[model samples]
Every structure is written in structure tokens, then in C-alpha cells.
Target: MQYRWGSAWGGQRLLGTENIEVAIINRGRPLRSVVLEIRGRSPNGLPPVRMFQEIEELPRNREVRFELASYEMPDEIEELNLSIVSSTAVE
Candidate 1:
């Protein structure tokens, strides 16, 4: 699985600031309630920001998209990180 920002209109923005977008792909078995941890930092050397999110359900070989907004973030992000915090597979 991988993550990246979406297009201009596809991203989520609050009051035309801080556009955020994410895509999660499931290549293994079916999963339920998948949790994700996202981290990022601005160029000004401010403390990093972390965010957590979950996907209700994800099937094998499928993908999901998410749009997020953060007022604390600037329009351009210098560094960003994404990781799968936890997930459970459905038999």
C-alpha cells in the first residue's frame, strides 16, 4: 500500500488552506477496521503533527480514498509520513 496527495480539486481543504488527501490500497486479505497513523512536519522546524484514522472495511485487491483537512498545516508540506497502525483480517 502507498499514500500520496490528490489533485487540486480532489484534495480536502478548509477555507482554501491545507489541502490533504490519502489513498490506501489493500493487496492482501480482506481487512476490517484498519487503522492508520499519519505524521508530517512543516519546513519551519515546528514540532511534527500526527493524525490517526480508520477504514471501516477493505477487501483484497481494493483501494480506498480519504480526504483530510488540518488548519495547523500549511498549504505545502515539506515532509510527510504514513504507516499502518493496526488492522484485522476477516476470515
Candidate 2:
């Protein structure tokens, strides 16, 4: 699995914006649902942030973009980590 920042606006990425966009690519089997765990530290001197998102019916060899918005948006994400908490494989 691979992930990167995504932008809804053409060619204009929101690097330091309130809303964060993440693009996830599925390189393996199809999934009925998947839970992604995200952890990062903000540059605003606040505590580390943790977030989770559940994607449904993701097909193989596909990419999806999810927007993350919380009470505080990190000006810059550091030591960011993404993990798969749970997933249902579609046979």
C-alpha cells in the first residue's frame, strides 16, 4: 500500500491548509472495507494527532482520495505514520 497527499484543485496542493487530502492506492486484492489509522505530529506545538477512516468497497488497482478535517489542522505533518487497523478481503 502506498499513500500521498492529494489535491482536489488541479495542480494546486494544499500543503499548509486546514483541510488535508490523502490519496491511497490499493495494490493488492479487493477489499470490502478498510480502516486506515493515521498518526502525525503538528507543528503548532499541540499533542500528536491520531485519526481513522473507513473505506468501503475498494477495488484493486484503484486509488482514492480522502479529506481529513479535525479541530486543528497541522501546519506541517511530521513523522506521519499510516497503518491498516482492519480490512475485509473480497473474494
- lDDT: worst 10-residue window of model 2: 5-14
- Lowest lDDT 10-mer window, candidate 1? 7-16
Clashing pairs in 1: none
Q: lDDT per residue, candidate 2, 1-91, as tens digits?
A: 8888634453555565546678888898998778989887867777887888898867888888887763455456655678889999998
For candidate 1, give the lDDT.
0.71
Q: Residues 10-57, candidate 1, lDDT per residue (tens digit)?
A: 645334454567767777788888888888776767677788888999
**Candidate 1 displacement at residue 16 in angstroms:** 9.0
Q: Note the Cα lDDT for every prediction shown.
A: 0.71, 0.74
The regions of model 1 sitting more than 4 angstroms off are: 11-16, 72-75
Error of 2 at 17 (Å): 3.4
